[model samples]
Target: MTAGRSRARGVATAALLGALLSTTAGCGSSPSAESAETDGPKSTWEEPASYSYTLTSSTQVLAGTFRVAVRDGKVTEAVGADEDSRRQAHDLPGEVPTIGTLLQTLDRARSEGADTAEAGYAADGRPVRISLDWDKNSIDDEALYTISSFEPTPG
Candidate 1:
């Protein structure tokens, strides 16, 4: 029984690894701009709705979906990902400094040796950008990923 459980775990891990590999491989090949825009307008802020993007690297892969709402130049709602992804997103704001407070954070992270990073904002004014610096390296090793959505909440 113990051996069977171990095998099952190994299989699950392998599956995840395969998925990650596939995603990274896809990223390796530059995607055509036209292909990337299969749905919605080119600019997310044009309309009030949700947007999602999948980010993947050789080491890890993550999917982030954001629901943004703006009204009268004020941000009404900003929600990202599902429960698990939300947990990851929650750690983002606190870990990295805000764009307003420190604009150079992105550049600095890039210079260090980061693996993945991204920046985004709403058309109104509110901006939410999340960046990940793996191994504390420069942008060369980092991946810049971003998702900008727009939606207005009730007053």
Candidate 2:
């Protein structure tokens, strides 16, 4: 192609890209923008007096079972299955996502289009599953987390 024609095509392409970006730049809300008042009583997860659930990867690999009671925002009586999980449930303090952080991530996924790679939630506002990719639109099966068999720990 002629230099003039090539330059014209490049300019057109750049203009189109610019227009698309400008429109989308302001399209989404940040997680911090989520209203505290609008969230009401359900805004934060109530510390489950007791809780139990199985954690799994996107590929359905069992990470472990987390069985514990919260006696002041801390896990107690922690128990975990051994055959399948990588670590004991008691080791979850740093290994896995907490209820508060996971919920914030899920909320961001709902409001911020580009922030989350994939996400799902329970009907009662809990993180049933979640994944994060930030700027990339790719899936990481390893990052995929599914919380199943959620139940309040029985006395």
Candidate 3:
């Protein structure tokens, strides 16, 4: 009976160790864009050639990355997760948001003019935490958007 109990305990220990090892193993050299969250120092804002993003607003959010065709500083096309969204996005014209539009918003905040601009970045200098408002201040904040899970797509 003692031996049986010992074997069970040993099995439990091995299971725990295996789970720990597997979790650590996933954090190897190549981290996916979703994995590259910035809980660290922020450097200059460097926009990748192309990327995927999750846009969150006060009311709604793009469920996943929306690919787009950029032409002359605008989103010419908005690619969605499915065919229905694709058609809707494409039909909306400039109403849809894309990687280009997000970057353009950041750039405009500096060069064009913004009411308020506060941002945080990742180790790789991607903007992870952003709070920009076209109107109002921290007290009565409105029109502020936060972007996250930004992963650079290979050009």
Which prediction has the highest lDDT against the true structure?
3
What candidate 1 gets wrong by more than 4 Å, as runs, is 1-22, 26-30, 34-64, 69-76, 80-105, 115-131, 136-155
Report the candidate with higher TM-score, 2 versus 3. Answer: 2
Model 1: worst 10 consecutive residues (lDDT sum): 34-43
Give the per-residue lDDT digits (tens) of candidate 3, residues 1-155.
Answer: 37775455445534543454367457777645433433223335655656656554321222223455444444545666567456556655555665445556656665545665545445565555444444443222322334565556555
lDDT (CA) for every model shown? 0.38, 0.47, 0.48
List the candidate 2 regions with Cα displacement exceeding 4 Å. 1-47, 57-71, 77-93, 107-114, 137-142
- Scored by lDDT, model 1 comes in at 0.38
What are the models' TM-scores? Answer: 0.32, 0.45, 0.43
Clash-forming residue pairs, model 2 = none
State the TM-score for model 3: 0.43
Per-residue CA lDDT of model 1 for 1-155, tens digit only, reads 37775455445544554464356456745534322312111223232232222222111332344443444433334355477456544654333222232225444555654554334344343333334445542222323344333223344
Model 3, residue 117: C-alpha shift (Å): 1.8
